[model samples]
Target: MSWSMSLTSFPSRIQTHPTIHLLRPIKPTISSPPKFPNLPTIRSVQGNFDHSPITPAKTRWETMLETAASLYPLYVTAGAVVACLKPSTFAWFVKRGPASYSLSLGFIMLAMGLTLELRDLLNLFVQRPFSILFGCAAQYTIMPAFGAIISKSLGLSPALSVGLILLGCCPGGTASNVVTLIARGDVPLSIVMTVCTTLGAVFLTPLLTKILAGTYVPVDAVKLSISTLQVVVAPILLGSYLQRTFPAAVKFVLPSAPLFAVLASSLLACSVFSENVVRFKSSIIGASLASDLSPVLCAKAILSGELGVIILSVFLLHFAGFFVGYLSAAIGGFREPQRRAISIEVGMQNSSLGVVLATSHFTSPMVAVPPAMSAVIMNIMGSSLGFFWRFINPSDSKDSPKVDDK
Candidate 1:
């Protein structure tokens, strides 16, 4: 079950289907000068393909794809903000159907699978098994336990506490790979950690949530396990199969996959927000910390109560994860880039999956709030951290080459 990413670029040149036109570099052609030196005829041939028929379209297509990829964070932020302002727009995306959230999650997972190849994964594990293992361990260990501590320390409500715990117990997100690349971190380590945690989530998410959140409410680990399998595992495996069997199609879709996943996640987050908008509005203004708590605890409680305990709980969970994850990795003797990767991976939970699971399993809309809010908060926080890290040089260049999953 080991894995590695292929060096080959997506939308590979292996086009098997007819009627699918791929843009390829046109070979350079050397033309002879005019036969007669006296009367020179100028041919409109350009070496840079300006004269080629397909150049404009190809350039435009490539630019569009690049733009989408570059603005992923912006798109996600805008979607969440807009959904908060007017939930109706995104609410419609979910209203049309049964399994809307599940289907959207499945689509995101499929896109992730298309980007992965078994050969690439195997190469990665063969080269750096320890880094991957440490990252996965951190994701499962640091985040979940810290989440419970934060929730309890804040004294969150039952639904909000459970939501925070679920957010923590969930796996690393696919988005972490994108952030790692932006941060110039260990992309391979990030991807491998994400893959490992996601697969492990079938057991870990439910088991941890039950253990941590069981105090808040009765949790059914078996039910959560089945739901996770249905949404996460099946689609990802099917997508991997399709990638191997129908690479041409996968290639066609690969360029758009990440952006598509972002959009899908945003929509899912917004929908959850919309469904609980009324409760959300009321909850935000409802409570505050009393004199019974310590000064530090009282300050956090005040923020949580005023801002809606769910948002504050989720924020503290991810913020603590980012800080502690990096500190722990640095202490473990990992280089800066590896520490960055571990931090982002640990901080960004599969929030969409959290939203989906909460919506499907819990009766309370409040339960889904933390994850939905996390979808907005984590990206902004992760992106900011990534950009900050991008300017700093890694401690060792050797660490960079060994963990480059790209």
Candidate 2:
């Protein structure tokens, strides 16, 4: 019944197969990763390798998945373009209404949970509480504030402003974990920060949205809290529990989880994009505040000035999050790797969660647009930053030890 015993009980196929490869390493390790209690032996993500033998077909399959996952931003971009041009393709995901978005988001969170080790997250916190907590605080404080400022400066429509702020208030996205790995940063630090901020979002997201975005529309904080629990907390907890209880089963599917999550995330955002495009085509761009959705864009809205403003706002919001996040982490005296981890964790957000909350709760189609847009923009920005850091040298202070390059 013990965790280790359960892990040891993995079927021989899994024991021999090494069923996952989440990253293509910046530098592959010589030997298979050591089984550190605090670390999962993901080959590239943690700077380790799986020297275990496997069939050629399995290797090719994993390579394709890894390549696909690495190009996640492109997939998101393509999905958005498709949503803009052929909105009908994504109509099925929205056929069930907002409930569909929530379900898709829940499934993605579950996938994220299954990939995680609860014990590792806990031990990470016990050992490095300040860095994680500081990063979480910045995630809440910095981005939400940026959302407010940018919207005001850009004079975004009320619905769009709310969408932007809500996007900011949501927790760090699960995507940051992979980006952190690519950046050659402290993957454990990034993962722990993400977990902390997400749990915290159940409270902070609603409260902050109420404060920053309340003027634009009435925010029922209580309803928001309950929804967050249902769509976000519940699935993550269930997935983590499943991961612990059925390690082998989870392991069997781990190889494909990230790729699946990537596609699902793209679909969710594209669903919103298509919905807003429909709303725009129906001449609903400037609907009254009480109406269903104050539409932000149409099929041709990409050429419109308002769409330009929305893109600029989203870009500025994330750019500031990345900039301020790194500067703050450096100020906090973290090393280069930890700084990059904190920077990424603060910069990228759970924008899909933002999209769901905006669509499910807010009436304005425009309210969902910012977060949907964010889902695309943040990934592009984060991935670029990760690669930029990855190519550079990360030199810690002479006295201090190098942070978890494992």
Provide TM-scores for the models: 0.78, 0.79
Off by over 4 Å in 1: 1-60, 96-98, 283-306, 396-406
lDDT of 2 by residue, 151-185 (tens): 99989999999999999999998889889878888
lDDT of 1 at 310: 64
List all candidate RMSDs to the true structure: 12.1, 11.8
Candidate 1 has its poorest 10 consecutive residues by lDDT at: 44-53
lDDT score at residue 217, model 1, on the 0-100 scale? 92
What are the Cα lDDT values of the candidates?
0.77, 0.79
- Name the top lDDT candidate: 2
Name the weakest run of 10 consecutive residues (lDDT summed) in model 2. 1-10
Best TM-score goes to which candidate? 2
